[model samples]
Target: MKYKVTQETELLNFLLEATSKKRNDLKKALKFNQVLVNGKSESYHAFLLHAGDEVELGKKSRQDLPFPILYEDKEIIVINKPSGLVSEQTMHNKSETAFMIVNGYLKKKKEKAYLVHRLDQDTSGVMMFVKNKKLYEELTHNWNDYVLERSYQAIVEGTIKKDGRIENYLSENKMQKVYVSNKKGKKAITNYHVLKNVKGYTLLDVFIETGRKNQIRVHMSSLGHPIAGDRKYGAQTNPIRRLALHANIFAFEHPFTHKTMTFKTEMPETFYKVTGKIKK
Candidate 1:
């Protein structure tokens, strides 16, 4: 339950191992509330400790992350996550999540895969994870500058007035759920165009230039055309069985191979069924 930091230890990695939270959860614990540094329950970007900083687990702390892999290689892993599975697990939240599942998979394989990206629990689709040490190092080193062409498909309420782009900053308040803001947040951009309109819902082809959390759902909502079945950001409409978002395609240059690689997932059958189109 405890260990002193060594010269060789990465602080965040140490914290995840010590406190049993994923890197992101530890960031939340540090960034949000409840968890503390040196007995003070707050985060200061300047806070630094050398060898000994006690990480006390809150009474409700636990990490049980879970997720599925759509594709994997020596360089990366892609996940076809189902709705209701979290992308990552946390200490304060003991529920199963995609991160916990990935962690378990890696632990069993005795391999370490760095966290590469995220997807919402209710929005099922493709997510990528890096495999092998060298590739992991390369991706993490250049994540902010990563230039993968990531795209999605979603069914939104009604047809969009026009196929276009949405730009904004996204940040969350104390609740930890992401929120779209005109100011005081990270810059996010989403580009979408209608692919089909049926049964009062429009299926759109979406391209995300920036990967802020829930950018697609928020952007669609901002246009008065929320994603179908998005209970959190949109009206509760059961006509659609699940949050109508799908990470259908990911096209990028493999960091190691420098070759363009495109991975695609077939649209869930429910998506077609809900829209009254049964694929032949």
Candidate 2:
């Protein structure tokens, strides 16, 4: 929706009054970089809108991009982020994050994207982001309802005898290292099914019910099968020379449209090379 201002007003106030949306919703729209002024992406809610200025709401047009666009619509965008890229910048990592890359691509088109979830820096996988605040609020507030299934593919050390599920309480210490705790913590659950045993390593299809920090890494390590190359979780092997974790599948319904959407990615080639042979 586009609005041409006939009188001077602040961007946010004008949006709230014009659209009849709650203040909080309008704030989220602005914070997520959804608002546009005069064909440029604007973040400041307090941005002054002069007479005759143009304002746009809802989905913005996306231009050609340098990176692969796995899927994109007016409501959401899914990107296949490469390994070694942080999902978002942190105090330790200030540059070259996937969020920046996506937003940068959109910025050229005077649009913006906002992340709904994250992937570890060393994990390559499909990631999702929302384009507008209403969708963002609906998805974030009722996350589990929208996300029907999420699965990961990983190469873990040692051979597993059979499929299993790991259920335990996980908590992080002051150093941010996640560990299984009996006395206290949030419940973490991981279900794993062995896909193939190559050489001494096993390829497993992993699924987690809860999105805890390092849930997969910690659960696998507790079973004496830490993902290869995850030094933080006590793996001695670096078979793939990177964390052998990849988010390979997501099945969900659109929050607003309620349309079923499923996405999947093949395991990284490195996961196959170190295992001696790739499974057909």
For each candidate, give its TM-score against the true structure: 0.69, 0.75
Per-residue alpha-carbon lDDT of candidate 1 for residues 215-272, written as tens digits (9 for 90 to 100): 8988888888888888777745745456878888877766766787778887765576
Q: In candidate 2, what residue range of length 10 has the lowest lDDT sum?
A: 59-68
Candidate 1 residue pairs in clash (backbone atoms < 3 Å): 65-100, 65-101, 66-97, 66-98, 66-100, 66-101, 67-101, 86-98, 87-99
Q: How accurate locally, in lDDT, is each candidate?
A: 0.68, 0.80
Find the number of clashing residue pairs for candidate 1. 9
- Give candidate 1 misplaced runs (Cα > 4 Å): 1-69, 278-280
Predicted structure 2, TM vs. truth = 0.75
Model 2 ranges with Cα > 4 A deviation: 1-67, 276-280
Candidate 1 positional error at 3, Å: 52
